[model samples]
Target: MVPQNPGAAAAGRAAPVHYTHRQILEILSGLMIAMLTTMISTSVVGTALPTIVGDLGGQDQLSWVASASLLTMTASTPLWGKLSDILGRKLMFQSALVIFVLASVGAGLSQNIGQLIAARAFQGLGVGGVSALAQVILGDVVPPRERGRYSGYMGAVFGVATVAGPMLGGFIVDADGLGWRWCFYVCVPLAIISLVVMQKVLKLPKIKRDTRIDIFGAFTITGAATVVMLILTMGGKEFDWSSMWTYLLAAVAVVLVIGAVFAERAAREPILPPRLFRNPTFVLCSIASLAVGVAMFGAMIYLPQYLQIVKGMSPTRSGLMTLPMVAAMFVTSTGSGQVVTRLGRYKWFPVVGLALVASSMYLLSRLHVDSSKLVIGADIAVLGAGLGLTLQIMILAAQNAAAITDLAATTSGVSFFRNLGGAIGTAAFGAILNNRLTHHLTEGLAAAHVRPPAGGGTSLGTPDAVQHLPQPFKGIVLEAFTQSLQTVFLVGVPVALVGFVVVLFLKELPLRSSVSRVDQAPSTSPAPTDAPASTPATAPTPNTTA
Candidate 1:
């Protein structure tokens, strides 16, 4: 009979149970669906933001619509990971789903920007949980050797949802009688479905451990992250880079981070163990994840702007134009995962992936106002292939290198760096775009003897502003936008190269074939018939078989 106690095997009284392919797939279906709902919630809201802000009469608070979610999501990711390690994955994941669905409903029903922002911030907490726990659960269920095969599917789901979210959001926003509220409402049903499926199918051994919650460490890290995110989101836009406000915020961020480090060291159960940083593989992987985030998010934030402003594509068309990149990412991610699983080697994937990313960024840097759509698609596809190769592989490596007990924390740590990098990259790149565009616009307008409007070059970023300008002035503005975007792409090239270089130093660890810790002694007793059949937790093996 299935053991009454799920933790029995984990406690070493019985053999660790292994899931069959069918069972694994059944579990994965729920996990992926849950993951897709989170991704869609973020993406679907993106295109609707302008409409939502207009309806809510909060033009000044526009950025907070997105920033609210991002800040809380990044800050809470590590906490969720560590919590799952202390508690159980299934409960944490379900809780996240429920929170997300409730928040979505609240967001949909909001009467003002304040309410919407608060709801979105709450949604971010859930998103953080779902994102961290999903990977942690994967680490718990799948052996490192076989994880690649499934990771490919997870990556593809992420890529697809990202691409589709905007498209669906735009459609909903433009449809008569539907409006932007439906964007939030749409996620509720899907989320409920995911919750029900997960509740029924997800079953994992719960490890009951005596561990103290690192309350002080959690506060410090959350404070540090919030400070950093605020600085990134507000530095160039809300305050001048050289302003005292900027300096004060930066100083506060640094001080908080230092405080977090000290707090972590003294905690009985650190949110992020100090030992993780000491592991060379974890360090390299974290760096690589950070670099990838910088390049990927930096580029993604601006691509639609380029298409819509420079090419004059409609929002729907702009979303459609990114299909090549998404398609290439899906294909490459799935294929690479299979290759990694079969060969039992992963180091080369990121090496080659980063190389492609660098090459694509450099190529994109050369685009001009007259660049062909085919050329743009080809450049982005290359970058997509690079992303597909690197993102999951790095996380897999980190999971493999970590001790079984650290699985959740390690997974979350890797995610934390990536999110941190994305925030920094998006902010830095936005500043670059603003600065370069302004400079180009001023020079071009002066050369044409055309006086800029009251806001000078500040208004040029708006498509409507540029479209209404006199002939020569409009052309000049378009060229400035094109040049600024090219520079942004050029900046991404070096960041991608940094990731490539970091990957080269990553120490390759043998992929373990069993779900359990290598140190855990194997039990010879047959698995209880009712218990799931699990491969014994054994030491790493050389076997390459899938």
Candidate 2:
């Protein structure tokens, strides 16, 4: 056996300590709380948006409220990740929390849709930081083999927040004098608590580096994302598809993307490293992430509409009705993590998961106006299981496959693509819903020998509006909505199938058993001059916890 070094032991004791499982849990408590705050903030706003728009009187600006946040979030995600690597993770995370809380307060107090949209855009910066860094920090603290279990817990938190946000928002909206503003305010206390907890429990080693902010690259990418999102969000709804505005926006997006590629290539510390694109694992994972985002967000946004409009369920009831999906997702995500930790295998999970997502979407497409809630619940439960298995595992695979230096970039890259996909999917699917609804409504009204108003189906905004319409007109509108949503689900089926196909090509690597790659360092590196005479020159042994 090699002799221990007295001087080395002294230095080790003086150095910053690594975290134990208990300490990590303490840190995760803060992280999860922060994550929950972000999730709730985004989700809660959805149910309250109608009320907000009505109060603020900007029906034209309604979609911007969601689109603005998503646009900024996608654009800033990579920058946040790169910053964390250059600066310290903990400081960046806390900064993100403060920004989010302040923005939430601003949102709560907004007098117009413009102010609310602006506040949400600012809030997206904070959200971008938190979402990217949360995953990065997990990679920092936990070894790959053990990270799966913690990922499951995070997924469960995500699932719970998703279901609860709408329910809570609906309750607050219907409650006397609570109003839509409280939807934004409720997240404030939770965020404050998260910030305090993180300050107390989180301790990470700070690495000082020369920071080079990619200002031009940041601008180009943000512009590109904004343009793309605008085209998607406004092309069909705000402007005719054949209009010059659509073509102009699309052209501008293409140019910005090209410029961003060139800019990133020359930057000292690129926001998204071009080298990552060369990695097959990163590329495949990004594609799958994009497809998953498209599928998941499309369903999440449209299904609630189906429940509220077709079934005439209240927002609270619609949120509660989604419990079956959330519960199944929670169970599967948690269970899959434990299984991955135990077996050290994960490729099968996503492969099977995507298959289920495709199947669920197909099943949902078959629903009609008279379809029972039980059937709807069963279909969505399948979707939840698929999402649980696929979503977190992609991040794990990307993290495991990335170089140590590229960890944060990889995490944020995956997130960026997912957000991009969601934005595009939501907009594209929304356009589809609008177009199909108009066509069906026109046909149904004409068939019923009823004349549509002069604007021709322009007044149909929410399910609540449709619900109040007289007898046969309401029935016709409900049928149109049902058929339109079915088309949306049918479109989603192919997107999920693409993800399923892509996941099949993913090459799984053995999960790492340590936080760093020190064990894998070359054995030829010279030892320190002050080393003990009897010290071993071999590489450090890896932890074999499993």
List TM-scores for all candidates, in order: 0.88, 0.90
Residues 1-546, candidate 1, lDDT per residue (tens digit)? 112333554444433557778778888899899889998887777656545765776433544676677678778889998787666778889889889999999999998889998999999889889888888888867899999999999989878886888788768876888878989999988889998988887777565555668898899888887787777667767898789998998899888889889988777678888888988999999999988988776666667667767776655666677788889889989998998899989999999999998999898888888889999889889988999999899999999998776788899999888877776776667667767877898888889888876655444434434466777777888899899888988988889899999999998988999866686434444532222246333222111111
Which residue window of length 10 is worst by lDDT in model 2?
537-546
TM-score of 2: 0.90
Error of 2 at 104 (Å): 1.6
Candidate 1 off by > 4 Å: 1-15, 46-64, 109-117, 453-457, 460-470, 520-546
Candidate 1, position 303, lDDT: 73
Candidate 1, 241: how far from true, in Å? 1.9
Can you list the residue pairs that collide in candidate 1?
2-530, 2-531, 17-534, 18-533, 18-534, 18-535
Best by lDDT: 2
Residue range 207-275, candidate 2, lDDT tens digits: 444447888898888899888888877877789989999999989989999999998887766888888
